[model samples]
Target chain A: MKYKSQKVAYWFFAFSMLLLILQIIYGFIMAFAHLGYDNLHPVIAFNTARAVHTNLLVVWLLSGFMGAAYYIIPEEAEYELVNVKLAYIQLITLALVGVTAVIGYHFNYWEGRKFLEIPRPLDWLVVANVLTFLGIILTTLFKGKKRTTTSLVLTMGLVFAALLYLPGMIWFDNQTMDSFFRWWVVHLWVEGVWELIMGGILAFLLIKITGVDREVIEKWLYVIVGLTFISGILGTGHHYYYIGVGKVWLIVGGIFSALEPLAFLAMALFAIAMYRKGEKKHPNKIALSWTLGTAIVSFVGAGLLGLAHTLPQVNMYTHGTLVTAMHGHLAFWGAYGMIVLAFISYSLPNLTGRKLYDSNRGVLAFWLSNIGMLGMTVAFGVAGVAQVYLERRVGLEFGDVQKEIQVHFLILIICATMFTTGIGLFIAEFIRYGQPTDEALIAATDHDA
Target chain B: MLSKSQAKVFFLGGTMVTFVIFLGLSWNSLSKEVPKRTHEENLTAQVVAGKHIWEKNNCMGCHTILGEGAYYAPELTKVYERRGEAYIKVALMTKTPWQPRGRQMVAYGMSDKDASDVVAFLKWIGEIDLNGFPPKPDLKK
Candidate 1:
């Protein structure tokens, strides 16, 4: 940590860890509910559990990204955050809103729009909070010594993400129109702007960890993001394919969404190439493993697995089936979840002034969580394929099909337990790092590599 | 051979072009195709009210409509046609938990009017043109 304000990032990351634990707990609830142990029906309900699980994932990721921005912006732009106090206030409000929304889900106080389950009134608060976050990042960037491409891409992603949230808030009586605009927020965020944020952070990590030159990394960054938009924007049609949209989407969405994997492929290849090219290898093996793991796993999870069903032909059968649950689990974990954890692992040592880089526990956390998630992904995929065959293909009843697949949920719960244990170890290490302090601040930022 | 400047151009220029096309296509879909396909003229106040009830109860959180939402329950985009108004009304207005084959649903215990409104909403959704989704089981014996 080179700047005083960068320490604020630690709290955001800590908060993310808390929310993630909650998310995993909710995930277990839904999994057990699937396994015929829905004893919490009157109290929590599957829908309520589902909403909290998915929404908490979103909130924690956003908090992690915000923390990444706080930590990255000052160093890249060569300036301190404009207002540390406002950033803290923003953090508090973010938590309050998240907690309130999670509590409200129990009582059925939500919008029922899947990922955008936060009620409309609370939507305005989210907008305000995000605007305040953008204000701080933008002000800090403009007032700094220079505006690097890395910072610009990251900030642009943040700005566009805030802008995209607007379309989801619009009330529509027609479900088609309602779903149409909701994709503008959900699809565009995960496949679109979020990739930009991921790319920007990935570039920064490579530069620091691999000792790669900034120029080379930032150049590939542009190409990667360019590929992302070219494919991802039109790729929104994949969702439109089954919704009440025109047939043009069948063609446009199929062609472009098929190309979406290319971006992930490029990202994975880019990270690997940078790693091989770098002459200086930093001693932070754990961070390097996560950074590389995210790129590779995202390709298989987001790119290859997505391609397994992106075609309109295959999707017709898999559209609402557990097939989606299969792809979604890995995609979110690889693309966003792991990236946040990677950034945390990379920065934690620097922030706390502790060079606990050689711990066997840290390495174990990385592999166990990743392999466990992979196992869970396979369980979901097997159950999903069986469901598509039984419910969609063989014309079995939905409930009967679910009963047949109950065994897979047992496997899912077991794998998830392994994943949770890994995260527990990660968090234990996080706590052991103590807290960020002024003594951790290094005199020279360029000394990272 | 891509230089830094050219890559930047590619990023900005590609984003601009694709965003324009996306907006244009969205406008066309919303303005031209959606009305005709969805039969917007039939979106009566009761249907809108039904949608309100759907959202208020967070039904999509459990049962999917349009192949979007949680897959915990059966897809309901065609429920109006499959189950008919009376069957759906029973499920809605039932005072007890409506567990089908032992999987429980929240017993909204809605009023008759709200049930009918929800039925109307499902009916409207049932007729919308989805370009042949939830495809028939070809291998079914």
Candidate 2:
């Protein structure tokens, strides 16, 4: 909290958490619906719940990323945000657009695309909102005394993300063509640019928490992101494999997507190596747990689990089944969801000037949420495998296979309860920290971070 | 033994090369391969309207078309071939929730024209060359 403008990040993070709670509620709605309890089918409906669940996830993660940039950019670049008022305005408009889209889903006013479901008109508002955010960030970064690789990487990821959103917005009468470009936004963002954002944030956190040399960390950061693009950019082919594309993708996607895991493996190893190499250990044990947890878990969820089915041979059987859901839950949770929580855990003390770092609740929240998510992942895995075998392999009807797997949703629900409780505890701790203050600002040399 | 500058170059050079290749492949796919495979001639106005109806209702949220949507219902990519137009129309044009087995689908209660449009869209999707996707059940007795 060296700069007064940094306080805006707290609000963004808070708003993100609020949406997260809402996102979890919708997830439960779908899980129960899977268990044959479509009691709310008329009201929330599976489709509406599904849209809200995923859209909230995208919005909340974006909000978290924005918060991370606001917090990190100032400290790294040695300047305040160029326009704090405009940043807040951007945040408000972001929320309004997000809320309007979610409400519209209930009333059947949406584009109905998988991830890019926000209607066209509101998409323009999102474009405007993100531009405002980027404008403030870029201006502040360039105007400041320094331009570290860390900040450059974060800003680059943000800019590329905004640019990539265009392809999804393009009008295409062909469903195949429409889906072709949609992945340019959805898959590319998560697997491609979003990893860059994750790497930048991870590098920044490692430098701060471990007192590692910035030069050493940034060097590895480059190699890791290099691997990400080398593999991830073309890794978009995996989504194209069955989407009315040419046979060229079957080979390209299988090969490159298999290589995609290497980036996550590198990331996981890089973080662990950095932690062990550095002598200084910041006392924020919970943040350290989350930081380390994200790296390792992402490797398992995104890397290994992804490899499990990414090969064309395996995917042919598991293409549209719950197996994709299994991979999706963990990949997003590990790579994006956990990283946001990790950044929040790291920054909260600095923002609020409250050193409530190593409480039992914090540790419990970390393990419970993680274990719960792991359980849910396994539940999805078992059910997805069964669905593939019964429906795709044995040729059972889709509905009959779903009935056979109905019990797994019960397990999913119980595990989701655990995951939700962990998040609830995390939120409770967030509230307990209260708001940021100018008094929290400390001299650059004197601060622990 | 890579220096910081070399690492930067690696990141920049790799990204540039891969992005170019990706663009080239995408252009070829769109301009040449996709039209041939998807029978661009068959994509009638009714099919386009059905695509609109599919999106308007967010049908992908539950039923996967081209194996790309939620898995709540069966994949509808080949629905027209598998279940004929009348069945799909009954489900879509039904005024109440279309419950198959036990799972409930939002009853759009669509007009006959709208239902047929979606059927057309599904038919168009069904004909696309997917390179052996939705593979035949290997273990089926």
RMSD in Å for candidate 1, one decimal?
Answer: 1.0
Could you tell me every candidate's TM-score relative to the true structure? Answer: 0.99, 0.99
The number of clashing residue pairs in each candidate reads 0, 0
Tens-digit lDDT string for candidate 1 (A313-384): 899999998889999999999999999999999999888888887799999999899989999999999999
Instruction: Please identify model 1 stretches exceeding 4 Å from their true place.
Output: A443-449
Candidate 2 CAPRI assessment class: high
Ten residues in sequence with the least summed lDDT for candidate 2 chain A: A440-449
Report the error of model 2 at residue A304, Å: 0.8
Top candidate on DockQ is 2
Q: Which ten residues in a row have the lowest lDDT in candidate 1 chain B?
A: B96-105
TM-score of chain A, predicted model 1, versus the true chain A, to 2 decimals: 0.99
